[model samples]
Target chain A: MAWFGRHGDGAEHRPRGRGREPQRVERVGLDDLTPDPIAVLGQAAYLQLGHFEALSRAASTAPTLEAKGSLSAAAGKVLAKHSAIIAELDSRGADSSAAMSVHTAAIDRYFEMVQGADWYEDLASIYFTSGLLDDFFGRITGNLDGGAKISASISSDAGSEDIVQLLADGMSKDPRLASRLAVWGRRLVGDTLLMARSALPHPVNPPAGEARIEPVLTELMADHTRRMDRLGLTA
Target chain B: MAWFGRHGDGAEHRPRGRGREPQRVERVGLDDLTPDPIAVLGQAAYLQLGHFEALSRAASTAPTLEAKGSLSAAAGKVLAKHSAIIAELDSRGADSSAAMSVHTAAIDRYFEMVQGADWYEDLASIYFTSGLLDDFFGRITGNLDGGAKISASISSDAGSEDIVQLLADGMSKDPRLASRLAVWGRRLVGDTLLMARSALPHPVNPPAGEARIEPVLTELMADHTRRMDRLGLTA
Candidate 1:
C-alpha cells in the first residue's frame, strides 16, 4: 500500500515554486504545524481554480442538461472560492498573480496525473479529491497571519451538494456505479494527499517532517471516507 | 472564393435535429425568413454554451492573471446568456435540454473546425464568431414567436468589451500581433459563416434558398468586418 505523501513520484523533492517556497516550519497548535501563509493561499487559490477548469470542461461533456447545469453551478462555486483567496492575497498587498501562479505548475501537474477515465470517475475524482484537500485546508487553518479570514470566507463555500446529488442520482440509475466509483475514489487518495503534503512547510528535515505529517494524513483519509460513504460508495 | 454557407462539406444536407427540424421556410418579412422557433432556441442556446466551454478552457492556459480574469468573466457572461435562452425555452413549454442537444453535434463540429492556433486567435475566434452570430440573430428579430424577448435579452449580452480589451492589450504589448491576428481572423470566417448557414432551414430548394440567403450573408460579412476592426485586425 502506497503511503500518503510519497508515490515514487519524488514529488516531495520537487520545487513547488520558484523563489516563494513553503515555510521551513511554523508552530501553531500543540502538535498541529501550520504551513506558510503564502503557501496556503497559493495552493488554496490554485486548487479551486483547477477544479473550476475541470468541472467546466466536464459540463461540456455532461450527457444530460441536468448534469451540465449541476457541473456548471459547481464550477462557479469553486471559482468563487478561488477568487476569495486571491482577494486575501491582494489585501495583504501581495502580488496576487505571482502568489497564485507560483502554485500553478504544481497544481497543473497534479491534475494531469489524475484525470478520470470516464464521466463518473471524473466526478468521483473531484468529489473525493477536493473533499480531502478542503479537509486538509480546514486542518491547517491556524492563525495563518489573518489568512484565517480567507479560510472563514471559504468555509461558507463548503459541501458540493450539487455534485453529491448528481453522483447519488447516478448510482440510483445504475447500481454497478457503486463498486466502480468506490475503486476510483480509493485511487484518488494518494495523489490528493500528496497535494496536501506539498502545501505544508517544506520538509527541511525529511524524516522528522514525514513523521509530523502522519496525523494530518490520517484525518484527511477519514474525512475522505465520510465523503465517499455519503455517495453510497464503500471508501 | 468560397462564399458564405457552402464550404462543400455537404453541411446544407445535414439533418440538424432528429424530430425538431427547422421550419421549412417560414415567411416572416417581405424578404426575410425566420427559422423554426425551436431551431433558433436550440442553436442560440448551444452556441453560448459552447463559448462558455471554450473560454473556460482558455482561461486555464492564459499566460497572465489579468487574461485569466478576463477570459473567466467572459465565460460567465456567455453562460448567463445560454441559461437565459434555456429559460426562454422552458417558458414556451419546450423541452429545453432536447432543444439544446439537437444542435450540439453540429455546433461541436464547427468549433472543432475553427480552433485558433494561439491565444490571440482563440479570443479573436470567440469575438468575431459570436459577434456575427448575435448580429445575424438581431437581423431576423421580426416577431419571432415571443423569441424576440430572448433576443432582447441577448442584445444586452452584446459586445464582449473585455475580450476586445484583452486583444487590444495584446496589440499594444506586441506590435506584430495586429497582422498575425488578422490572418487568423480571416481563416475563421469561412467556417463561422458556414455555422451561421447551418442554423437556417435545410434548404429544400437550393438555388432559390441560396439566392435568398445572399443579402443576409452580406450583412453578416459586414458585421464580421466591424468585429475584426475592433481588435485592430483586418477582415
Candidate 2:
C-alpha cells in the first residue's frame, strides 16, 4: 500500500490538468522531459528481457505441448523485441547495460514472487503479467516524443493470437480454471504494481506538488480491469 | 555396441566402392529416390523439434547468464527451422506427425542419457550434439536430390558464432574446462551415434553384402575428431 499512500495527496488534484485546453499546454519533446526518457525506456527493455527469461522457463516447464509451443514462440518474439530495443538504445548512446543492471534485481524478485505452482497458474501469470506490462508501457510511450517506434514494436511483439486461443482453450477444458485464474489475475495486478513501485522512477512516485502519478496509476488499473473482464475474470 | 554389431559384415567390404568414378552416380531426381526423401526429411524435422524441446529445458536450467542466453537463442533458431521443415513437409504431403512419433523414444532416450550436470555441461552438450547432427544432416543431404535448401537452413541455423565464443570464453576463464569439455564432447558423439543407430534406417545398419556403413561411420568419426581438434580437445 506504499504506492497508494504515496499518491494519496496527488489523487485529490487529478482534475486540475483536465480542464486546460490541449492547445494551451506546451509540447514537451524528448529533451524537454523532466526525467530522461531513454533511461526509462532502457529500463523497460531490460525488464522485458527478464520477462523473456521467465517466460522461457515457464514454457519449458509447461505441462501441455500446446502451451509449451505457444509460450516458446512468444518467448522468441520477446527476445527479438528486446534485442531491437537494446540496439536502438545503443544507437542513441544510452547506457543500456547500466539500465539493465539497475533494475535487474527488482524485476527478478517480482518474478520470484509470482512464480506459478502449475501449468494453469503459469499460463495465467504470463498472460496477465505481460498484458499489464504492455499496457503500462503503451500508456507511458503515448506521452513521450521519440518513443512511438519502441512502443509500437513492443505492442506488436506482445503475445500472439495463438497464445490467447491457447489460454481460452485451456479454460474451456476446465471450467474451474475460470475461477482459479480470476484469483490469479488479481494477484498478478498486485504484484505488478509492487514491482512498478520498486523498479520504476517518477512519475510513478511524484514530487510533493506533482499529481500526474495518480492518473497514470488509475488508467493502468482501469486497463487491467478491462483485460481481466475480457478473460472472464474479476479484477 | 549394438550399432557396431549390426554392421559387422558390412565393415569387411568397405573398400569395394573406392575406385568408382565421381560421375557414375546417375543423378537421380527427388522423385526417383527410394524410401521417399520427403519421409527422411520429415523425420529429421521431427527429430529437430525434439532437440528444440530439450534445448529449451537445458537453457532454463543453465547456471550462467551467458549459457542461458546462448542456449535460448539456439533453441529459437531450431524451433524456426523446425517450423520451416514442417511447412515444407506439409507441402510435399509427408506425414510429419507420424515421422515425429517414429523416432520419439530413441531421440528422447538420447536426451535422457546426456542431460547435463550444470551450465558448462549443458553448453558443451548443446554445442556438440547439435554440431554432430548438423554434420550428419549435411552429409545425408549431399546424397539427396532436393535436400540442399533444407540442409543449408539446418547448417546455418545450427549454432551461431556467439555459442562458440561463449564456450571458448568459458574455457579461457577456467583452463580446466578444456579437459572437462573434451570428455563431454566424446560422450556426445557416442550418444549421438547410439541414437542414430536406433532411429535411422538402412546404411547405418546395412545388410551383410553392403560394406558402405563402415566408411560412412569412419568419415563421421573423422569429422567429429577434426571438430574436437578445432576446439583444442582430443578426439
| Best-matching candidate per DockQ | 1
Per-residue C-alpha lDDT of model 2 across residues B1-235, encoded as one tens digit per residue = 1222232333345356565432322121111223345656655675676677677666656555445556766777887777777676776777666655565566667777777776677767776777767666655654556666776777665554666677788799999999988888888888776554433445323453234344556666886787777778887
Report, to 2 decimal places, the DockQ of model 1. 0.36
Native contact recovery (fnat) for each candidate is: 0.52, 0.20
The residue-by-residue lDDT of candidate 1 on A1-235, one tens digit each, is 1122223223333355634222422221212445667768877877877787888978978888778876876777677777778777787777777877788788889998778888878888887777777666644543465545665655544337878887888889999988889888888899999998887775666665565567567767888889888887777
Task: Please tell me which predicted candidate would have the highest lDDT against the true structure.
Answer: 1
DockQ of each: 0.36, 0.34
The segments of candidate 2 whose C-alpha lies over 4 angstroms from its true place after superposition are: A1-35, A62-66, A197-200, A203-210, B1-35, B50-71, B95-98, B142-145, B157-159, B203-205, B208-210
* Candidate 1 CAPRI assessment class: acceptable
Can you give the TM-score per candidate against the true fold? 0.74, 0.81
lDDT of each: 0.71, 0.63
